[model samples]
Target: MSGTTWAAIDLHHHVVPREYAKALSKLGVTEGLGVQLPKWEASKALDVMDAHGIARSVVSISAPGVYFPAKDPTSAVAKQLSRAMNEACAALVRDHPGRFGVFATLPVPDVDAALEELRYAFDELH
Candidate 1:
């Protein structure tokens, strides 16, 4: 091997965007799948990535996805929340280009809305 090193790309990284956390708090959900949510900050995540020799991390939301409790996943609220989360992730990628990337969140169970978001995430956000 040559005297060169390559950094790793983490595809399964998780991120709890600020707006998403606030929405969850409003819904009285402090945990996901019965486990408490862990604190997250982009700076901290970047620091950890640097320490681990990770070149980039593709961040996405962790479970208890978009809808919560008895809320219908097809509802407007679900679409709105998904959009907010995706936008927040986009912002992270925007703020720290090359260091972060996004796995856009979709409002699942709402096919039309999901399609719309897919288009927006690709055409607009990209």
Candidate 2:
């Protein structure tokens, strides 16, 4: 299974810094139970890939895709979450090389943050 190949991009994942995840946890989102969905770890993601024979995964922001405001108290927290998560994504790609890719998660609903993140992600990261 590990040797087998399939294109994949588990972009809609979350393995952010603990504090950030906890803050998100406080927001409390779930399908039905109302329990906060636990953060998704990169190792768990990779392990799943190993099990499923997925060759690679492009990690990116899922829904809530940074609709969080970039101002307020939560704004900094949101920005930190966004930055930390994106950095984590990059690190995952770095660790896995060709097996992984990452898309920047901007603190959005904020056009300024989106454009800023875009410039940074494309210009600097590229």
Candidate 3:
């Protein structure tokens, strides 16, 4: 090892943008099913990296990140929310290059929709 001191990459981080926050911020937000986020200040995330000597992070979406109010969890609305969340995440990483990476979200219980989202995230978004 060259003994270079750089911040380690944290592969798991969440930023509940308006898209993910919207569902969680519903009329009756509660525990268990409620949307939750750490004190997701970007500065704070970076601060941890600085304190821990980590230079980068590869972020991922945790479970129950975003929910759909529709009857079917595999509804188009869910897909839309997923897409929006992905977009926002991409933007965040783009805005802060060399510091963050994306861990995309897909409206699960919907395979086709997830595939489409993958295409969009990798292809169109790229």
Q: lDDT tens string, model 2, 47-98?
A: 8888877777766654444344433445665566666666666667777788
State each model's CA lDDT, in order.
0.86, 0.62, 0.68
Model 1 segments beyond 4 Å from truth?
Answer: none
Cα error, residue 109 of model 2, in Å, equals: 1.5
- Report the lDDT tens digits of candidate 1 across residue range 1-126: 799899899999998877877888887888888988888899999999999999999989987788653755347778889889888888899999999988889888778889999999999999
Task: Determine which window of 10 residues in candidate 3 has minimal summed lDDT.
Answer: 27-36
Model 2, TM vs. native: 0.67
Estimated TM-score for each candidate:
0.93, 0.67, 0.78
How far is 95's C-alpha from truth in model 1 (Å)? 0.6
Q: What is the lDDT of residue 55 in candidate 1?
A: 99
lDDT of 3 by residue, 1-126 (tens): 598755466777656554555565562443233444433567777777878878788776554555554544447666877788788778878887888888777767677888898899898666
TM-score, cand. 1 vs. native: 0.93
